[model samples]
Target chain A: MSERPAHGWQTVREEVLRRIAEKIWRPGDPIPNEADLAAELGCARATVNRALRSLSDDGLLDRRRKGGTRIARQPVGRATIEIPLIRTAIAERGARYGYRLIERQEAVAPGAVSAALGTAADAAFLHVVSLHLADEAPYALEDRWIVLGTVPEARDEGFEAISANEWLVRHLPFTRAESEFSAVPAAAARSGALDTAPGDALIVHRRRTWLGDKPITQVDMTFAPGHRIRTQQ
Target chain B: MSERPAHGWQTVREEVLRRIAEKIWRPGDPIPNEADLAAELGCARATVNRALRSLSDDGLLDRRRKGGTRIARQPVGRATIEIPLIRTAIAERGARYGYRLIERQEAVAPGAVSAALGTAADAAFLHVVSLHLADEAPYALEDRWIVLGTVPEARDEGFEAISANEWLVRHLPFTRAESEFSAVPAAAARSGALDTAPGDALIVHRRRTWLGDKPITQVDMTFAPGHRIRTQQ
Candidate 1:
């Protein structure tokens, strides 16, 4: 063996990695052992072990405590984050995003809402209903309730023209959030939101958010038919 | 008004989350607003908002600035972790995960190998070839080269009876990793090792990892038809 300074093994590992990436080799394929490789490269067998050990960590190569290293049959799934704008999503998809106000009411909080905010049962509240459109088509019909107990400023929040969804983002600094998902058969009135025939499968999401530990907002959303959900990083 | 402690809203949110787990409420469905709901339950609207907003953060809901909240659409792809398991993945699937040692040769580091390690030629190394299996079928073939210069301890390791994958995991401590994925047609020997007809689509993963700043390992993996990869939290 040449008396060259150490650090040669890294080269071995990289070349091997490239061959594998280029499909020069394949998954589940065995490779040469150390002694044989040492002779071929005119070096020592010790160098090859250093490289193989590293592949085992990233969940790419499977190495048994006693078995040799091999390419993974399955791959690690990658996640990507995708945040889209509603108007953009609609316009790009050959549809229109529309909105309509349905009903507006002011009422005294019953016991539950009052208790939620540690207020009196008659605490003031705002209630509103609206329909949403995508591509000029009915997409979602929303019925929402807002508490004005802690957010007494909400008494004049001007929700009649601006939607609650838009209002909060511009005005709030929400920090914490939680969500749940499921699939259910649609009811007649709600099923019309997705243009699906009644009794069709609809994906549903329920959510709540808080600024610190203080609850800020809650919402329930329903999607149209053939709409997909994805989270990628 | 009779004053009664309210606890059911919390219970309702919990039930809603459970319903999501049970696929009852899908990704998107508009829920009843607070006032209308208070009339039904004789409670408060604050309770409902708490439940809904919590569900939003769990990646199950889409609340827009103005479009109203809607159930998220599931993305086509998912995160799939390629757990490094050879025997279980092979035998369990009725397909085989297999391995076999090929020739081992000692030599100087190859040109590409030296460049990756930022080393000069005349560096000592070992070259090896091995075969991997699936369902009693040859799946991946490895042609690797190891460097003795960096991993001096590797000089003592032998390949006659013991496999390299087994030895490396017990010894190495890898920290950083990089991975790339692509597709390719089959090569000459790959056609035989994979038993494929050749000219078929194959998924591949190329990965390299390091211990701290010192590069530790590099590996490539290829997949056959009818193989699925899944990654999730």
Candidate 2:
């Protein structure tokens, strides 16, 4: 029987990575055109194009419309931060996950929250405050606003048993999102919820999700002191 | 006269994104197989495959080897953080960029630094501390260690005019890197350099880069208070 052909784009991508890692194609070196590379590797030109595009997205290669492809001279390291479900993140650490809803009510969104969601300052939203715990210790304090105009169901459903974070993931469809990462001193009110002292350094993660052009939710999560987001590329 | 063919992978990708955005392919819905999609779109099977794979990488689709592809029910929002050269970042902000070498000396690497670099505990490294300024205001304080065994040229040069951050990027070839983002209280020593009060919240970014298995350098950058990293997807 003939062996299965190993000409997939993934195999091509691996070969390209190997060449760069081994310095076979040194930095700033211009790689062969896709057509030439496909001919040499005995694969379709489309396969080579796909592999090169993937590598370029990863910041390993530079491809210009008319400049062909070259190994990146000063490769900007790209670290992909995948914001996981808070409960899943806790469970992944071999810790028991706990969540408690502190407050849920229809309230007018703050000016910043309104601006982030592209809603009016007087827009009423389903406001939710909750705490996520890992091993019964404070993990993250979540403050969320759901645009009632886009998600009318949120106003009726009480988020007492389930967090809006998890509920929205199951109920809504997100097509786009924006996130901001910063450091902030914990306010007195939030510090009590997170079980940290006031003025303690905290990692603040603010995120907004959209379904098409309609805003779904805007959330700010303040992690307990010493929380870190780590990634490798 | 025939018009140019519009059957590329990019066209397929755009169509897929549109369907998802329009809720035509709702979350958790299984998408058509590659062969069927290719026939329907009048494109090659490889083009459909490439488009689907790209979407899967972006966390929009979940493709199982035996189960086929489906729209992700709980799509993980991926934020790509590109760590740019400090000078370039400042210039992009429309600020005058400035750099100052606080200290540069050959010293024994600290235990934590050596461990991070995968070097000996007693390894001697080029220790460099520098301050990056935007519009004459301190932006970030950088503490870096260069592995002498892998980058011996760093030991001969004094980083007085150009920062080690810029020098390494121009001289080295990076195959892989790891980054960590955390919140920390500014220490007294660093607080002075950043012109911030002690115990202020700061965004601490730690990065280690490698050429294959060999470590090139490890650096810790502590940004001034209120600095935020933002990204959209």
Candidate 3:
């Protein structure tokens, strides 16, 4: 069995992960060197090295040039935040997704919005507000500002038929983005749109995206009370 | 310079990152193959391979057996969620951190909490409530349940001087954890402890951790209105 068939790097990665998960190798305990592990597992040394490097990237193991590799003593749960399309999110849950365009107009960028996008204070932008629903109930209220200077094509695509949220995600692929998660009391407008009483607590997701140095858009999504987001590695 | 001195893989990774950040290779554009990049950068092929593999894990590059490697068009910001100690978080922001124990008691685990921990309902747990303060202002309220079966040592840690939140982080090195983010209205008890009006919106972070198959602890942290969490890659 030592000279068994060749395997992919992913197979070696999963085996290493299983060993760590099973406590066969406890936290802070150094595992065998790459050459030794490769010999024992009947895999190439290069494959074993790749697997260990990947595990280290996930905060599962600590690797050093001279000290070798060991499991992390205190592993920070390294989760990937995949910003999904709103429609796709609802669809994955087997819920019927609904979208309605509330308002759209060309307006001067607000001070906060301008600061978020790193644009001039009073720069003109296309302001759009839309509501997303799951099963005909309010799920989230999106308020967005798209910089016309950065995305000129947005001017031609009037947002009356399609949401600026979906449109931007499809048309503009950003290189850099910043996002914040917070809670806020539902204001008058938010309450009306979300069908909730004013002053009710709501979770808010705010994001700003840029393509290289050009700021594309900034958006704030306010979810109805009891809305939750689960993330996993 | 074709035979440049040996360097660590991290050095090559950063150099590749700088080139991408500078837009020398635009998104959707393929850079040279591994052999070519190694030769041009005067590094070992294995070193270059490690750097490319790391970048691919980060969602910055797409690599395939036949496709070589190319910049990502729509990069999903891969962020590592480093669950920080609240005290450290407040101190990092240049604010004074304070902890107050609200209540402690032995009680049956709630149905939801029990299910989250994969334990049977009615299992006795050490329920602890506490408040975290930043510069004398209410910051977050924590509600936690420690599995007595898995963590009997917690019974001795009365949690008067040190918070259970901090204590668990120090004592427990969990191998598995799940977290959820949501918004909920501040109920009467939560409002009183958090110094917010009833029905006000609050951000809630819920987490359950396990050591191998044994459940360790589950915690819910509710932040005051306007509290924000920013995560980035």
Candidate 4:
């Protein structure tokens, strides 16, 4: 074994990936033990462990406490989707960002919305509807429901200058969140809000955030047709 | 400082996350240095560093080599999407999985397809169209283009019993991949394959895989309406 100093876990990870790509370590095959690999590569066993743990997180390897490590039989592809503020996203695309408040009121939460937030069906929520614009064109239509019990301050704010999305992000920090991505045909109201023809396909991102165990807010943002979220890995 | 033995970096991470969630460490504020935190928490500096690094990876903290770490001003919510084999996905939903080959041929790649694959527009590619089913109902429609040069064995394989998606996972490995999620109006052919009405909104997942710098395959999988990809964090 070459007596090279340990460069880092990242270097070890790249070497392992190269071996996998070259089929030197074939799929479903057991890899050398960490101590053996460390000795051969002139790296600490902890470095090998870290690299393997990271590969496991990426769904590329199976590392068991006692069963040893093996190449994943059916490696799954994992991609990270970063949900950013609409204004930030628009700015990143080099477009001018705009926001318009359509409606805001305290209304009874719908059954589905209530269920999503784990609240009573007849619970009152601060409902806010708004439109996000890019370069003076309709970009996304947002419909949001803020739990009044969790965010009583929202009841006083008019939400005219800043969107509920931006306001909540600025004021509240959530400990947990859930997101769902789907496609839906634009309804009449949604089409009008987005300046799209009725029945046009639209991408919808639905998110619910919570502080500890208490529900905070739920929002659905429907993007205009042809919007795509892309990621490279 | 607590004299307890370092439970692990994970425990330290949880404590840090609690501090952030409770606003003890406000957004955009510089966090305690690793050495200071380690001393206060009675852990190794490396443990504090690892915890901070993990938080940074989660987009909750911003770390700099010289400037130190700080709470992210605009913390981005990250969701990990796992793209599994269609059959496996169906099985996980407790449904019987089925697949039918719709079309298979060698065709000149379209301009958009070639651009996505980083190949010549007129390059010849093996094109395959198929439908996946769950519980005897249409699930997802898959359209794929495979580079013959990168996957020569595919030219010989019929892909009758197994899908190219599974076959490639078994035979080849990719070093890099890109995925795009979008909403599209189903064309006549796609609608027929998915058994949905024309103009129905479909969630389309497009992916391209590369082995090193050489392109391997590009595929588009369109899910039927009402299908959502959900993740929690």
Q: Name the best candidate (by lDDT).
A: 2
- By TM-score: ranked, best first: 4, 2, 3, 1
Which residue pairs come into collision in candidate 3? Answer: A201-B201
For model 4 chain A, give the 10-residue run with minimal summed lDDT.
Answer: A1-10
**Full-model lDDT, candidate 3:** 0.78
Worst 10-residue lDDT window for candidate 4 chain B reads B1-10
Clashing pairs in 2: none
Query: Which candidate leads in TM-score?
Result: 4
lDDT, candidate 2, A54-75, per-residue tens: 8887677888888789888783
- How far off is model 1, as Cα RMSD? 18.2
Evaluate all candidate structures by whole-model CA lDDT and list the values in order.
Answer: 0.53, 0.84, 0.78, 0.84
Q: Which model is ahead, 1 or 2, in terms of TM-score?
A: 2
* TM-score of candidate 2 chain A against the true chain A: 0.76
Alpha-carbon error at A13 in model 3, in Å?
Answer: 13
Sort order, lDDT high to low: 2, 4, 3, 1
Candidate 1, residues A117-138: lDDT per residue as tens digits?
A: 4445675667665666786776
- The CAPRI quality class of candidate 4 comes to acceptable
Local accuracy of candidate 2 as per-residue lDDT tens digits, B1-233: 24234768878988887787555786788899999999999888988998898888767788998889998888356788888899999999999999999999999888988998799998879999999999999999999999887777787788888999988886666767889999887653565799887657899989998865678889999999889998888
Q: Which tens-of-lDDT digit does each residue in B116-231 have in candidate 1?
A: 65555777766655666775677655555555554445567765454444444444434455554443445434435666543343444445545434544444455553343432
Looking at model 3, residue B127 earns an lDDT score of: 95
Candidate 2 residue runs with Cα over 4 Å from true position? A1-71, B1-26, B29-71
Model 2: DockQ score: 0.41
Off by over 4 Å in 1: A1-233, B1-57, B61-78, B94-97, B107-125, B147-150, B188-191
Model 3 lDDT per residue over B48-141, tens place:
9988887777566779779879876662344445667788788888999999999999999879899988998978799999999999998899
Candidate 1 vs 4: which has more lDDT: 4
